[model samples]
Target: MDLQAIRTFCRAVEAGNLTAAAKALHITKSVASRRCQSLEDGLGVKLLARNTKGVTPTDEGALFYERGIRILDDVEDAAQAVKHTSDNLVGTLRFTAPRSFADLKLGPPLMAFAQQHPGLKLEMNLTDERVDIIGGGFDLGLRIAPELSDTSLIARKICDIRHHVVASPAYLEAHGTPKTPEDLKDHNCVFYSNVEAAKQWRFGTGNNARAVRVTGQVTSNSGLMQLAAAVEGVAIATLPDFFLEDAVRDGKVIKLFEDVPRAPSYLYALYPERRLLPLKVRLFIDFMADWFAVPENHCEV
Candidate 1:
């Protein structure tokens, strides 16, 4: 019935005991027990069966528990919304992002956002492996490339990443420049082995994208590794611009077929499906969209 009492009840369920719940909620066990008791009494149902091992939610308790979770979420959302619209949007934004994107650039924008919104806090996780944001307890996520599997989460396309087929200047000179996608077949191509068809490189061919089957003397599942190989003139690599900025800038790799058509991977910001996402999540998504809106965001892989 009461928000605080329901919060206490859910806390007890998550913690498995009144004492632990109080510890988690920074309240006394007596207060925790009182809240849980009041919540159960108001609903006219036994919510928990306390035993020597721990507190377990009963069948009726389980039903109440689900509703209780939503109630707690609403309370948190309300508090965050209030603070968000206030002078400072103060709260922690738990974020996950692709590994390459994080190591290179995510920190600067997030740092700037935090500086502007002094009350905002960020907990960032960077990894190549796709994460389950809801299951992993993340507030939001950043992703690039073809949209992965669809879920209940809300995804916003932030930018388009136009990829490049580049090889080191030396490699181009040694192997000869590839004037077309067919030209790559003659050159030793380094590949991202993790891709479903590493041996089959796709390129724009009229109305339909055509696939080119090739042999690579060197290959690795890691995009970074492939970039390194391409930089050293081992072989030509096709990778997103984000991972090859330095190499491309220094003329280490030469972008080929600039006039030809190419595929573009999209960058996206994702959040849960809840109607009331926390202010932290909402603002973080806005900041990311703004940060990636620059002209140089062309990348593909």
Candidate 2:
């Protein structure tokens, strides 16, 4: 099979149309179509189903694309190994991360990594909205949770993160404090509406774990928004400790249920499963793991 043909076909599949694939590869639509046709002819199988909507891989094409992607990654890794040092790595890495974490904690480390690999092109989308990694063609996804509900993606735990239940003094004074998970239902609570069970607030871990259904005047996808509402005495909120550290220290919010023990959360680097991971992706994962392992960096959050 022609390497260029395989490359073009893979790009077409990812881009969902010949015009998009062609534009991405800096080639004309005719050229991209021809390359894909040549690839199909050489393989003796119809790789793509084309229509007005877009092109999608056939069953056989899906199998071939999966293996083809792995093969291409391996070949690229070999070329990079011969031509460049680890620091001299080059390529575009597109990723999506939660805006709450990215705004507060992700900038320094990401910038440092980019500086260390100046040849690399970084494309990041920071939003609390959940994104489809495969559909979006993202190289990776960064997430924070006690455990990932999505089993489709492979996840590597970069570091541990803590979640705290917090409320302003006035709110607690007015509504009284929640001593147990069950007390949460009686009070107005800020909800992070992005996750699977937005209103279900979890506490503890292992056999003692439980979730409480909560309601409030405020509902937001952003953790920062939830934190702000809690600080302004709107309602109680369960947010990552990174967002609460400053507010708690300043007496704007009081950390509650310290002795109750909530489920542990971790910073995870998530990516799609593949036969062989790309070198750039692997390097970034390792870099993140190492960077967060430091006491200063981890504690800063």
Candidate 3:
């Protein structure tokens, strides 16, 4: 069996389309189609159901892919074990991350890493939604949360992310400032819709912790949009310290509850559970941890 054809089949399945798989593999769509066809012919089985929209794997294809991907991973691991070097990091390094966090904090370090490893191709997909890391064929993911619900993936805590409640001066002036955690319920608050129980905003930690059920005029999944609403005096927004830094510094918004400590969320590097993690992915995660360890990299609330 042709190894390249197997790889193409696997990539096509993950990508949900031949075009995307072809792009990732640095090959033409025609070539990708041909490879998959060759693999199917050799096996005497129809591996793919191709339509104008994309391609879907047949049951046989899925079964083959399940085993083939592991075989490929093991093969790569064996090769890396023999000759591990930065120069050998030749291939796409795909990952996903939250758009706001990646745009705000991950840019510099990611670019620096890319520059350091000229042979490696970095493919980063930024979205605020929780992505299927394994199904998406991503090598890793960056997530910010108090805790992840998905236990299937391996997680490494990279850093603590401080969250802050903030509002525009005008909003506070008109609606009256929330003097305590309880007071938040009396005022309109912006919500991050992506979070479960988004209306229940938590404050403090452990014994003194409070979950304030907040009413909101604006709710959005995007952190930037939430920040905007707060800046525009639509409502108070509790957002990551990084999201509030610029607005607070420019006096567009005022940070509230300075004395009350909010439960800190964490920045985590997540990857699918596998026998051997790719060396490039491991190194990148380490680089992220080292980068964020610097005091200057942290945003002040």
Candidate 4:
């Protein structure tokens, strides 16, 4: 029943000789022998047999030893778990984000952060649905173009997502390319559905920085889908640079009305109010900034 008694008994069984076990346990020979005897008496079982050479375990002693090792292992794990709880940087960080942002901007930085802080755990839920940070027990959310009206939550702007109008070379060849924003009305356009009245894309041009309401034929809820349509020469699509940069570079999609790029949407880290964020979360946000803010990472990689 007592851990100390079990430990002493285990040592005696391992040593085989009472004198050796006594020295190993930092106790006298008589005390060591008495410990084994008391354990057997307490259990009403023969735990050890004394021969001329030394002592060996009975079947009952062998069973207890086997189970005892497992118990000790569990005890060690419990202690480690407690220690981990006390550490601020430890424990699982639950977060949510839009699917596209999670895949493109978040995954690489998060993976790097995980490697840097091996003890920390991260639970990422990728969804476009607006999640209640406090109610859902989330530590943070990577919100793109969010309106920070909630007084209870705080947001840190990490990066800006610039939008661009793109069309495939084939589509531009088939349909006379739009030389300016006014010419967009005649072309087939792809739109992201969540964006209300997406058929009407607003862009700023010239010193006045105006907004042009363009029309689109194909509409999709997913940014990737809009990008795919543009890539496949289906239609001209206006999308965030993050979504179209590769296609533009590879010549799959060509830019139109280069003078009038859409407004840049900010990417923010939203979290519940706290005096000081945990080091893990703080480090993660900083890593996200570093990974994204670098010029080399802009549209190339």
Q: Specify the highest-lDDT model's number.
A: 3
* Residue 54 displacement (Å), model 3: 17
- Residue-level lDDT for 220 in candidate 3: 89
Number of the top TM-score candidate: 2
Task: Tell me how many clashing residue pairs each candidate has.
Answer: 4, 0, 0, 0
What Cα-based lDDT does every candidate model obtain?
A: 0.76, 0.85, 0.87, 0.73
Model 4, span 192-257: residue lDDT tens: 776555666667635756556666667777889988898888998887777876777799988777
Per-residue alpha-carbon lDDT of candidate 1 for residues 66-125, written as tens digits (9 for 90 to 100): 887787778887776565673587766777888777777666777888898887777788
Clashes by residue pair, model 4: none
For candidate 4, the TM-score is 0.65
Candidate 1: segments with Cα more than 4 A from true spot:
1-73, 193-195, 296-301
Candidates 3 and 4, the one with greater TM-score: 3
- Winner on TM-score (1 vs 2): 2
State which candidate, 2 or 4, has the greater TM-score.
2
TM-score of 1: 0.72
Which segments of model 2 are wrong by more than 4 Å?
A: 2-4, 11-35, 49-59, 299-301
lDDT of 1: 0.76
Error of 4 at 64 (Å): 53
